[model samples]
Target chain A: MKIRVNGEGVQLKQPIQTVEELLHHLNLEKKSLIIEHNHIILKKDQHRESQVSDGDQFEIVHFVGGG
Target chain B: MLSDNRYHRQMLFEPIGEAGQRSIQESHVLIIGVGALGSSSSEMLVRAGVGKITLMDRDYVEESNLQRQQLFSEEDVKNQTPKVIAAKNRLQAINSHTIIEAKVIDVGVEELDSIAEEVDVIIDATDNFDTRLIINDICQKYRKPWVYGACVASYGVTFTVLPDETPCLQCLMDHIPNDGATCDTVGIISPAVQMVVAHQVTEVIKLLTDNQDALSGKLIAFDLWKNQQMELKVATLKDENCPSCSQAKYPNLEYQAQVKTAVLCGRNTVQIRAGTQKNFHFIQFKEHLKDLNLTNFFSNPYLVSFEIDPFRIVVFKDGRTLIHGTKNPQEAKKLYYRFVG
Candidate 1:
C-alpha cells in the first residue's frame, strides 16, 4: 500500500487499518502534530477510533518555539 | 471622490483597480478579539476603505491596553468604554464611508456558524489559542477565509487559512498547547504587534481583493527587539493529513473549552476570566466596597476598578476581571466576591 505524507508519496508494507494505528506504527507522537486527513482535522484522541484506508492524504505539522 | 492622481497610486497596483474597489466597498469583514493586533488591523482596514467592519471584543480600554492598542487614547480610558465601541468610534471618524459595528461580547462557538457565514472574511486578532482554534473551525466549516495573526513578547506569527486550498490553524497544530508560552510569562513590545498586524492587514487586503495566488504558504514569524525574521515553510505540511481540511470535521467548534487567563510579565497585572456572565454591575457593585478605602479608578460597560489597599480590583463588566498586585487565582476570586456583591 502507498500513502502520501505531507504531499510526498511513500510506500508502506503494513496495511494500516486506522490513522491511530498508522501513527503508532510510524512511531509518530500524536501530540506533536495536527493531523488532517482529506481536508478534515482529527483530534489526537480520536486517532484511535479513526480508520485510515488506501490513498489517504495526511498533513502532519510540528511546532517550533522561537521569537 | 478620490482624485485621479490620489487613486492613481493604489489603482496602479492592478488588484485595487476600480473593480477591486467595488469589491472592497461591498465586502464585510468581522474582526473577532480586538486587543493589540485587533485594534491595529481593524484600524488600518477601516482607513484603507473596507466597506463594512464588525469588531467583536469582550474587553474594555485600560491604561495598559493604550500602549499597543492604537485606536484607544487616555480619554477613552477615562470614558470607561468598551474597546470595541471605542475602536469603532475612532474608525468611523477615520472613514465615515465605512460602516463600523461594535459587538462588545465574546465570540463563542454557538455564534460561529451565523457570524462566520455572514462575513466575507474573518480576521483572527485574538490573543489566546483557544479562540483562534474556534475561529479556524468555524471558518473551515463555512469555507470563509480568515487570516491568523498573533504577538507575544517581541515575537509575532501569522498565516492565512483558506478552506479547500491552503492549511487551517488546526491543520498546522491539532491540540491547544498546554505548555504554550504566552505574553504573560514573557513581555511583548509595541513594535512587534504593529509589524505583525501590518502583515496581517496587508494579507487581508490581498485576500479580499481576489489575489489569492500571491498568498504565501509559510508561517511568518518575526522579532523586532531581537531584529530577527523567519518564514517557516508550511507548504510541506499542507499535504500532511490534516483533520480540519482532510476529514471535513471540526472539533474546536463543538464545545466551550476551559478558560484560563494570565498576566503579562513586566506589566503590573493579571487576567481573570469568568466564562459568560454578562450583567456584572460596577456602580452598584462599588457600593459594596464602601467599607474599603478603595477609590473608583475606572468604570465602564466593559470594565471597572477600585484601588483597594495594596492592589487594584479592576472588575471588567463581562464578569472577568484582573485583581492587580496578585498572581494567584484563588486570591483574585476572594477579592471578586468581597467587593463584587
Candidate 2:
C-alpha cells in the first residue's frame, strides 16, 4: 500500500492501519507532530482511532524550539 | 497638534493614520524573551511609537548571539550585558520617547500575571515552550491578548491569541515536542527571524490599533529555505479538553517543582535554578568566592561569573546560576551543588 506524507509518496510494505501505527511505522510516534490527514486537522487524541487507508494524504509538521 | 515627526511615515500608511498612531502611542506591550524574535519585535514596536515596552530576559549577551540577534553590539558583548539591558539601551536610542523597561529576571506565572495586567498585549519572544505555555495561561486567565512567534533554522511560526476570541497555543499544540530541533543544533538564519518578527509586529499593531478585522486568526508557518508557507485555519482548533483555555486550569503556570537544572538550547550551557529566591549580596558572594581562592571571576551589581577550567558559571543575585561548557543536566546539577550550594 502507498500513502502520501507531507506531499511525498511513501510505499508501505505492511498495512499501516491507524494514525498511531503510521506514526510508529515512520518512527515519528515519539516526536511532536501536528497532523493534517486529508485536509482535516486531527487532534492528538484522534491519532489512536483515526484510520489511514491506501492513497491517504497526510501533512505532518514538527514544531521547533528556537526564538 | 502632534509634534513628533519620527513616526510620520508610519502614520501615513492610511491603515495606521493619526488615530491609529495615537492608539499605538497610548498602548503598552510586554515582550518576554529578548532573544532573536524579542529584539526585532521590540525595535519595530518602539520605532512605530508603542507607548511603553517592558522587556524581560534571563540570559546575557554572548558573541554567538551577534549573528542573529539585532540589538546587541560588540561593546555589549565585551561588557557582558544582560539581554534586556542591551535591548533597552538600543531601543531607547531608537525612540527615546517610548518607555523601555528592562528586567533581567526569569519570568514565571506569578511574574507574568502581575505584568500582563499592566500591558495591552504580550509578545512571545521566548525560546522555550514552558514559558510560552505559561504566557498562554496568564493571557487566557486575564482575557488579555498576546502574539506568539518562534523560529529555528530557516523555518518560523506565528499566531495571535485574542483571549476568548481565538484559539490559544495549548489548543493547537497539546504536547510540547521534546525532540524539537533548536538553533543551537541546526543553526538559524537572519531572514527567518525577520519574517517571524514581521508577522508578529503586524498582528500586534492590528490588535492595538483596534483593527480587529485585519488580524489573522490562523496559525502561520513558513520556511524561507524551502520557499514554503502554510496558514492553518485554527479558528476552530480550540480543544474542549485543553488544560489552559478550555478547563481554565494552567498546569505549566502552577507547576510547583521549579526546574533545578536545565540544558540551554545550542549554548552547551546548563541553568541551575535556585531552590528559593534569595537576595544574594553580590559583595558577600564575591568575598566568599575570593576566600575559596577562585581568582578568575568578574563581578557587577547584577551578577558574578567565575571561570573553573572548562566550566564558567554565572551566578545571578537571585541565586540562579548559568553554567557554561556542558549540556548534561546531571553534570550541571553536580557542578551547581559542589560549587554554589
Candidate 3:
C-alpha cells in the first residue's frame, strides 16, 4: 500500500504495526526526527506504543543547528 | 483646546496622522523576551497607542536590569518584580488607553507559530539567539512580519523581516553562535539598548503605517559607543534554498521544545518551566513554602526565594522559578508544587 509523508507520496515496504517498527525499518532515530502522524505530535515515549498502518500519512521534521 | 491634542505633536508628522493613529489604535503587537530590548520596545509601543500589547518574558527584573530596562525603577527592583508585570504596570500608567497583557513564560517553539499569527507584528527583545531563531522560523511560516533587534556590549542591530518579501534572520546567520558571550556573560551598556530599541520601534511604526517603501533593505548594525553603522545588503539571500523562506517548513511547530526538562547552566540550580499551569504567582505561593526551612522568604513586591529540602526555590516576582536541585523535570515539578503551591 502507499502512504503520504510530508505531503509527498511514498510506497510502504510492509504493513508496519507500530511507530517503533517503522523507525527501525527507516533507520531513523527519535532524537533526529520530530514525528507528527496525521497532525498529532507523538512523544518519543509514546512512539513505541503507537501503531502506524499501511496508508497512514506522517510528517517527519528535524532541526539543523544554524544561527 | 482639543481633546486629541495629547497625540497632536505626533499627528503633525503626516505619516502617523489621524489615519495612522487609527491603525495604531487597532493594532496588536506581541513582544517576546522582556529584557533590555523588550522593556524599551513595550514602553514605546504602549505610549504610542498600540491597541493591545502582549509582553512575555521568562525572567524577573534584577538590580542590574535597572540600568538598561528604562521602565523599571528602584522600587521595582526592591520588590524583585517580574519584568513582564513591572513593564505592564509602567506601560499601563503611561497610557491607560492601551491594553497591556503580560505573560511570564518561555516563548517555546511549539507555541511560536500560533502566537506569531495572533499578533500584527512580533518584536524581538530577547537576549538569546536560539529564541530569536525560533521566532524567525515561526514568523516566516505564518507569513507574519516581525521586527528584529539585538544589542551586545556597545553594538546594536535592528531589522524588519516580512517573511517571503525579504530575507529572514536565518539568511544572515545560518548557525547561531552557541558561545557563552551573551549580555549576561559579558555585560551590556544602557545607551546601546536605547539606540537599538529606538531604531526597532521606528521600523515598527513605519511598518504599521504602511510606509513599506521606507522599510530597510539591508541588515542594520550600529556601535553606539564608537558611533559607527553597517548596513549589509542581503536581498539576494532571500531564495528557494532557505528552508524557512523557500521550503516553508516550520520546524518550531513540528517539534515541541525538547520537554523543557534540564538542569540550569549553573549546576547548583535547575530551572523548571510550568507544565500545566502556564501562570504561577510567587507572592501567594511563598506562604505555602514558609513551612520549609527556607534560608529566606522575602517577598514584598518583586522577588521570592526559599530553601526546601535538598533544593532552593528562587522565584522572581515574574512566573520564572529556579529549582536548585536536580535538573529532572519530575523532581523539579514535585518540589515546586510541594512548596510554591
Highest lDDT: give the candidate number: 2
Which 10 consecutive residues of model 3 chain B have the lowest summed lDDT?
A: B257-266
For candidate 1, give the DockQ.
Answer: 0.07
lDDT of 3 by residue, A1-67 (tens): 6777655677776777888787776765522334667756565566789878767877654322211
| Sliding window of 10 residues with minimal summed lDDT for model 2 chain A | A57-66
Mind giving the per-residue lDDT tens digits that candidate 2 earns over B1-341? Answer: 25567778988998889999999999999999999999999999998899999999998898999998999999988778999999999999888889989999887876787788888999999999888989989998888999988888898988899876787888777568777478888889999999999999999999888899999887778888977777667676787777888888876677644656777876789998864665556677777887777757777667888888899989887778898999998888888878777
Please tell me which model should have the higher lDDT, number 1 or number 3.
Answer: 1
Tell me how many clashing residue pairs each candidate has: 30, 1, 11
Give the interface-residue alpha carbon RMSD of model 3: 13.7
Candidate whose TM-score is highest: 2
Taking all chains together, each candidate's TM-score versus the true structure is 0.73, 0.91, 0.73
For model 1, the superposed segments whose C-alpha errors exceed 4 Å read: A1-67, B1-8, B174-185, B224-228, B239-241, B257-294
Clashing pairs for model 2 are B184-B266
Output the TM-score of candidate 2.
0.91
Superior candidate under TM-score, 1 versus 2: 2
Worst 10 residues of 1 chain B by lDDT: B257-266
What DockQ does candidate 2 score?
0.51
Report lDDT (CA) for all predictions: 0.72, 0.85, 0.71
Candidate 3 lDDT for residue B188: 79
